[model samples]
Target: MKVQEIREIIKLVDQSNINEFVYENEGTKIKLKKTETVTVIQPTASPDVVQGNAAVEVKPAAPATPKAVEAAAPAAAVSERENLHKITSPMVGTFYQSPAPDSPAYVKAGDKVTADSIVCIVEAMKLFNEIEAEVSGEIVEVLIKEGQLVEYGQPLFLVKPE
Candidate 1:
């Protein structure tokens, strides 16, 4: 199965009342299960796995509840900050704020950046990938600290678009 298909499946399951869903095609198997706080997707075997094409675990920030619904009203204000663009890790890896440990960080909060500006590096399987801002903006926050393990598509920085 393709990654996009898997993503669609996840979206369907998340929105539905189903607790578990399993799919198999050829030699690949995909299993999705929803817990109180997380939705996990893993392969029964070694094919079409998400994380490095191996295994993947997706966690929701919080579970759905009445209290959470009430809290969401305040959270909606966060959308006011939606103008901030997120700089996300392209792959699962250790996030490095600098090219090297002794060097200064590529960018920090309040730093200005344009599309293609190298904001940080994600080291996966010994390969260092320089992450870019992809938007013209001022860095508003660094979501993750240096040398932290970041997952694919995880937000690393928030930028206030210029």
Candidate 2:
């Protein structure tokens, strides 16, 4: 399915009681399961999924299903997360942690970074786009791995401001 359709499915699933949704057609399979967060898992075999061709006929459980009520995060954890600086993707592309396959990653957890430091690369349309760290801090978390397809504005790293 197209990225937009997948996004829509994600929204629909998040707003409803559906914890898992699967769609299979034309040798393509799409599965979305809600974890601690809502994420869209890519179809494994679909070469090109057209919009309105997914043939998704979902009958979600009632909106007020007991399992749909997620537990809220603790106040301390939420406060800590709020204080961190997030390095987000500027565009949709594949995330690359290192310059080349054999090279070490630019930064990892506990690494200190400056505003101009090259943190990673995102390859889009055969062009490798070097992503920079816009804030100076110690890398507290690397939210994405190499070669993962990331969406625009998705958090890549969480930095503890220095």
| Cα-based lDDT for every prediction | 0.74, 0.77
Question: Candidates' TM-scores?
Answer: 0.58, 0.58
Model 1 spans > 4 angstroms off? 1-77
Largest TM-score belongs to which candidate? 1
- Weakest 10 consecutive residues, lDDT, candidate 1? 52-61
Model 2 bad stretches (over 4 Å):
1-73
Clash totals for all models, in order?
A: 0, 0
Q: What is the C-alpha RMSD of each candidate to the true structure, in Å?
A: 9.0, 8.7
- Tell me the deviation in Å of residue 27 in model 1: 21
lDDT of 1 by residue, 66-142 (tens): 54454545666666566678887755578999999899999999999999899999886677889989999899999
